[model samples]
Target chain A: MIDFSNPLHLLAYGVMAAGLAFDLVGCIGLVRLPDVYNRLQAGTKCVTLGTCLLLLGVLLRFGFGSMGWKALLCLWFIAMTSPTAAHAIARAAHRAGYALWKGSVGDRYAEDDEGRNIQPAAAADRPKEA
Target chain B: MTALDVLMLGLALGVFLCLYRALRGPTPADRAVSVDILGVLMVGFCAVMTVATGKDLYMIVGLAWASLAFVGSLALAKFLEGRSFDD
Candidate 1:
């Protein structure tokens, strides 16, 4: 049996627990959020952090073995990609005209039928499309 | 069961929760984000399984999966960006 008394084991266990909690909470947010933008934000930040922490725990547990090295590489890969993926998804969602939540305060991307931005000043002149 | 095994179990539960989100998400974009979360969860599972089983191959599998997930997400995003994209 593995020695749970070891400091490394304890640390890995604790980090993994924390990562799991974060991941669960992020999933909850994804399900309960009112809009795609909010979901994107939650998924990008929470999952990236949770997955990286989990990887850190793995590195600690595995030391300098191939598993550890691969974990390290995966961590870097995720840290770099998750946000970019989120941004791309969000931009595409916005361009696709996925409606914002009814409670949204403002829409900077709102455009008139003439392809003009619709701000407060242009509210009266806003075309029918926006 | 060892602590690592329990942790892996929890990670699996988390993966299921992400799947639920992916299923119930209202819009294509929302679903896309769910997919992102799922990919990350897969990586976490891979990490835990490698250590628990004392195997090294799971790590490489996790890395390759992550790379593919990234590319898939980008392609999905591009398609959404241009809904007219046919190919």
Candidate 2:
């Protein structure tokens, strides 16, 4: 049972507000972003950080307990996994031939994938039928 | 009976709002992102519920849900790609 009069309670409130604010801001990025890849950049990284802070606040208020530990572990798991998952999604999108934003100057994945293609193994090999 | 309880309840409602977004999302990617966010929100909601209810048990359920949410999202995304999970 938390004592609302306790200063620690104030800290908890502040943490919750800040963390939720960050999370909502990340959502705004999702709504406003130009493309899926760009949205992934905002959504995965920012939301993970926001939720981690929120969990940390919960941990602080709840004290050292199983729940606290579980929260920390969950935060760590999300921090590691979310970005990797986003990367995988992006790679899949690319492979499925989703075009990059045309006005954008760069296409690194296209270049890298093209570089790996094997041009018809020595074109001269005795096949004159056309 | 308290301000913390009120605020926690509000957060829970906010979480539900996020959940609505997750369910009706327009794209697989949107749904995936929402599921991931919603998992964290669920954890946050459970933590606050623990505080509000003075019971730690809900946190365990929340954590378990988080794990399951991850697996479910991964499988859904795989399914979208026409990949078979049974293999």
Candidate 3:
């Protein structure tokens, strides 16, 4: 049983509570968001941070023990990989022709692709200058 | 119930929500994203378990799960992109 009277345990509980809140919100977003991209943004960012905070709480509760060290390791791994996976999923979704929500404001990826695809064609169409 | 118990219950609810999304998602991408989020949620569950049980093994499990989940998400994304694994 956690000793709530201990300041460290209280702090850990507080942190864990916050993490749970974030995770809950993220899951709600995942369900309620209009599109895949929107869901990805909400789910990935919020849940990643939530899980990291949870791990941090574990580290706090356990101090410098093996559990604490491993919690820190998991924290770092999750922080590093979650965003990378999100980015990859987003790119793949775009490439798979998953359309954005109608309310989406911009598509920089499409614009960038247009620029890359058009520039070469425009240059090729230009008369030989040399 | 203790705070940890409440936290764990909340996580389980979150997992069920993710499961709902995964089941009802309109597209493969949506399902993939839900599953990815589910993986992250499981890590939090493991972290809580580690503290609750005073066991270090759960931390190792969480670490392994995180990495495996990451790789699985990436593979699913690649498959969605219609490319070979090498590409």
Question: Which number leads on TM-score?
Answer: 3
Using lDDT as the measure, which candidate wins? 3
Each model's lDDT comes to: 0.79, 0.64, 0.90
Of 2 and 3, the candidate ahead on lDDT is 3
| Model 1 stretches astray by more than 4 angstroms | A108-130, B83-87
Tell me the lDDT of model 3 at A60: 90
User: Candidate 2 local accuracy as lDDT?
Assistant: 0.64
The alpha-carbon RMSD over the true interface for every model, in angstroms, is 1.3, 2.9, 0.5
Candidate 3: TM of chain A?
0.88
Best by DockQ, which number?
Answer: 3
- Every model's TM-score: 0.85, 0.75, 0.93
lDDT of 2 by residue, A43-88 (tens): 6676667777777777777777876787677677767766766676
Candidate 2, TM-score of its B chain:
0.72
| Chain A TM value for model 2 | 0.79
Instruction: Return the DockQ of model 1.
Output: 0.75
**iRMSD computed for candidate 2:** 2.9
> How much lDDT does candidate 3 score?
0.90
